[model samples]
Target: MDWTVKAGKLSPEKLRSLIFNRLHRRRSDILLRPGLGEDSAVIDFGDEVCVVSTDPITGASCRLGWLAVHVACNDVAANGAEPVGIQAALLLPEGVQDEFIGQLIDDMDAACAQLGIEILGGHTEVTTQVETPLVVITALGRAPRDRYVTSAGAQPGDIIYVTKGVGLEGTAVLASDHRETLLSLGVEEAVLQRAAGFFDRISVVPEALAAAEAGASAMHDITEGGFCGALWEVSAASGWGCEVMVEAVPVLPETKAICAALQLDPLALISSGSLLITAPPQVSIVEAVARVGAKAYPVGRVAAAAEPVLILPSGERRRLTMSVEDELWRFLAGK
Candidate 1:
C-alpha cells in the first residue's frame, strides 16, 4: 500500500514498535525526566536545564548557513528556552570555492547575531563524495529547570494550536527554486516575492518565545512531515490521541496555489518554521502568536481517542499518517 494514502496506512502501534525496536539502549542520566517522545532533548545541568536539538537543510544549497542556524534554533526555542549557541558542520562537494564558504559563514554569523546566539564552533571542508553542500547545525539552549515543557506534558483536554500558516518553508523553497516556472505561468512578480519571503519565516524563535510565555505545555516545530506529521509525533509521544479539523488548519493562498499546481498535499509538504504547540484551553495562544507577527489558529484538540484521527470538513474521518516519502522525496522523484 502507498504509505502516503490516508487508507491502508500502517497502524500507530506498528510504527511505534518499528521505531523503538531500532534503538540500542536508553540513557538513564536524563535531567528533565519526561516520558518518551518530547520536542527537545532535555539534559539536566546544575541550576538550569539544557534543551538540545539538531536539524539539516536538505533541499536548497543556497542559504545553507542561514537555514542551518534558524532551523536548529527553532527547535531549541520550541522548548521554551532561549537559544544560546550553535555548532555547525558543513559538507561541501569538491571544487567548491573559498568565496562560497566565506559567504556562507557570513550569512550564518549574521543570522546568529540577529538571534543573539553565538557560533561556538564548526567543521568545514570540501570532499568529492558529496555532490552538493549540506549543513547540519546543533543548537543548545537553556531555561529554568522548573519551567521547561515537553511533549509528554500535553494533557488530553488541552487545545492544540499552530503558529503561522501551513507550508511557509515549502512555499518559499518552491518560489525560489521555481521562479522561472512561476513567471512562465503568469504569477505576478509581487506575489512570487511574497512567497519567496518564506525563507525569512524559516525560524520559530518569536512564536516559540510567545507560546512559552503563554504557558504552553508542549511544543514541536512542524518541519519535514508538515502539520499532519507533527500531530502524529505529539500524540504518539504523549501516548494520547488527537482530532484535528482539516479546514481549521491554516494554509496560505500562495501555498494553496503552489500545492494545487504541483499536485501535492499542502499538509504533507515541508514547513520548517511552523510550530505545533499544546496548551491549556484558557491560554490565548492565537493572540500571543499575533503579537510576534505570526498567525495562529486552533486546529484541533488533544483527546482520549485510541488513535489519531483527522476530521475533514466534509464530515469524513480518516487516520493521519506519515512516510519516508516526504515532499523532498516526491519532488526529487518527480524531477
Candidate 2:
C-alpha cells in the first residue's frame, strides 16, 4: 500500500485504519487510550482517574505560550477534570532574542495563574531544525472515576449544545497574522482590533466544568476541524448520530466578515475555544453555560441514525464529514 503524508491531521478514515488499529499494548491501569474523540487519556489511580493531555502551539504565531497552556488545559477540562499543572516543552529558533523568550514565559505564567495551574518541569532548547518557535504543554488533571466524561457517552435524544461561538481562535489568529492584508482589503481598523481580541475567549474550561456539574453526557472541545468535524467525532465515538441545525449554530458578525474576506468557511475553520456538548433534552445546558458567563445554543440533537447530518433552515439536509485538511492551511497558503 502506498501512503501519503498530509499537512494537518490525518484523515479520520486513514487515522483509524493506519494508526488506531495498531494499539496492541494495553495496561490494566490505563482507563482510556487514544481514540478519535477522546481528548484526554485517563489513567486509573485507585481512588481517582488522572487525566492528561498534550498539545503543541503549531498554528498560531502569536501568543504561543498563552495558547499552549489553555489549549492543553481545555482538553483536560473537556474530560470534566480541572487542570492542576502543565509541563511545557519550549523549542526556540536559534536567532530568537532573550526578551522574546522571557515574554513567552511570562505569558504562559499569566495564563496558568488565571486557571490556577502550576508550571511543572519541562525541557527548553534552542534548535535550528525549525524556523519558528514551538511550545508544547502537557496538562495534568484528576477527577473521580465516575465523574470523568468521555466523548463516547452521548445518548440518543440528548440535546447538542455549543458554547461561545465557532471560529473564535481562528479569527484571532487570522486577525493577528493578516492585519495588513485585512487593512488593505478595506476592513476597518476597529474590526481588526476586535477580531484580534478574540484571544480572550479561547478557553472553554469554565463552561466545560459547568456543563459537567449540570449533568452533561459528553463534551468535546472544537479544534482543528471546527464544528462539523467535532460533531462527526462525538457521533463516531458514541456510536450514535446527530442532527446539527446549521442556522442555530451561532456565528459572530466579526467572524462572518473576516471569513468572507478571506474566502474561508467559518464552520470549517479551526476552532479551539468552543465546546460541543450533549445532555438530556430536559436539562438546561444553555443555562448552565450562561451561569458560567458564556453563551450557549442548542444547535441540534442526538439521533439513532448511523451518521451525522447537517440540517439547513430551508429544510435541506447534508451529511457532515471531516475535512481532510483544516481551512487554516488554505488561508495560509493563499497568504
lDDT (Cα atoms) of all candidates against the true structure: 0.80, 0.88
**Poorest 10 consecutive residues of model 2 by lDDT?**
321-330
TM-score of 2: 0.96
Compared with the true structure, what per-residue lDDT tens digits does model 2 show for residues 67-138?
Answer: 889989999999999889999899999999999999999999999999998998899999998799989899
TM-score for each of the candidates: 0.89, 0.96
Error of 2 at 35 (Å): 0.7
Ten contiguous residues minimizing lDDT sum, candidate 1: 5-14
lDDT over C-alpha atoms for residue 170 of model 2: 90
Task: Give lDDT: candidate 1, residue 75.
Answer: 83
Off by over 4 Å in 1: 1-28, 32-39, 322-324
Give the clashing residue pairs of candidate 1, or none. none
